[model samples]
Target: MIRMIIPLAIFLGLVALLLVSLETAEQRKLVASPLIGRPVPNFTLPGLHDPDVQRSSADLQGEPYIINVWGSWCWACREEHPYIERLGNESGIPLVGFNWKDERQDALRWLNQFGDAWTFHMVDFEGRAAIDLGVYGAPETFLVDHEGIIRHKHIGPVDQTVFEDLMRRIMEMRSEAES
Candidate 1:
């Protein structure tokens, strides 16, 4: 009888874990980034449009900005590009496009076809910089404050809801600084 009860208890515990996971599915999608409140990883990568030109983390100091990690091959990146364009056109914040593990020509073509919204673009062909940034996949975004510290990170495509959230965070940051 005791042996039978042990197996029954294990099955019930597994069911409970599954129930909790199912209940928090949406929350799980927003996987927290460890880089929050830390400095942006140092990297100097070539510009997507012009490989001879290089952009570095050091150059982005003294202003709040967004660093969007994307690849031409990522469908989610395509989904989020419109919102990113909106931010670049309206937010008054510089948007840095970090192209990871992609072919340079393909990246340029994608921007040309999709409408370039980034203030500038950097290419990480080998994905070395991405490792430092703790990248899990494409379409990740980082919000960096004026002091070059990463304030927030979103792990997936920035849909309309996520866009609003990002805008709200930017506004809050600005207001906090002004006071």
Candidate 2:
């Protein structure tokens, strides 16, 4: 009878542990990227509108800007597209785009259909630059400072709250730079 009770206790303990783990997993959020506070990765990709025009991390220096990683095929990008357009227009922040792993024509058409929010778009056709940037998926955004350092990374769509947070961080970075 004692031996049978021990087995039952062990089974109950295992069930409790599994239940706790499941609950924790449901509450988990996306982890913050370690690349925050680091320099932007080196990359040169062609412009989406004009392949002959290449943009690089070097060219993005001397100004605070937002690099939005998107794809024509990404539905989440569509959801965030209008907000991004508003962000560029309202904040006066230069919104650069990294068109990740997408066809140039499809991207162009999508932009034409949705309205262009990007000040300029870089074509990451082969996704090499996206890989270097540690991109997990489309619709990620990185806030880069005037010195070309990555200050913040947002893993999902940039809604009003996210944009507000981004602006706050940008202002903080600017103040830090001035001081």
Candidate 3:
């Protein structure tokens, strides 16, 4: 009887440990952020505003730029639209958008209703490009240096404070490069 109880207790402990391990693995997937201080991905997709303008990962190069992944279907995108305006207008970082998993017509309409703050918008109909960028959801912002290396990533809406802080950090990077 004593042996039976000890074995059962050991089994229960193993089960609890397994459950914890599984939960931790799942959380890692959801919380996995982009690998900054690395080269940004390279690819070209159709532009939302202009078909002639080739929006590519290479565009992220040659300037301190901001790549914002957004879709009309994403509620967070709508919430963060205004701050994107601040980035384009205030910070002057060639802001661009990845229109992930969105219909062309709906995207255009949404932009028209809100505001086309993006210097350029990529029409990512399938979200393949987004997967390559390690995007978990819309409204994720990446800061790339002039060399096209990702410096930082911000998840969720960008408010005034967030925008300012990012801008400051980007400016610091510029100064550091100059020095």
Q: In order, how many clashes per candidate?
A: 0, 0, 0
State TM-scores per candidate. Answer: 0.87, 0.84, 0.78
lDDT of each residue in 97-176, candidate 1, tens digit only: 99999998898889889999899988999989999998988899888888889999988899999999999998876666
Quantify all predictions' global Cα lDDT against the true fold: 0.90, 0.86, 0.82
Instruction: Say which prediction, candidate 1 or candidate 3, comes out ahead on TM-score.
Output: 1
Single out the weakest 10-residue window by summed lDDT for candidate 2: 26-35
Order the candidate numbers by lDDT, best to worst.
1, 2, 3
Best by lDDT: 1
Q: In model 1, which range of ten residues has the least summed lDDT?
A: 170-179
Backbone clashes in model 1: 0
Ranked by lDDT, the better of candidates 1 and 3 is 1
Runs of candidate 1 exceeding 4 Å displacement: 1-14, 177-179
1-179 per-residue lDDT for model 2 (tens digits):
99899989999999999999888884466666778889999998889888998788998888788899999899999998888888778655688999998988899999999999789999988888787788988899998888888988888888889878877887776676567
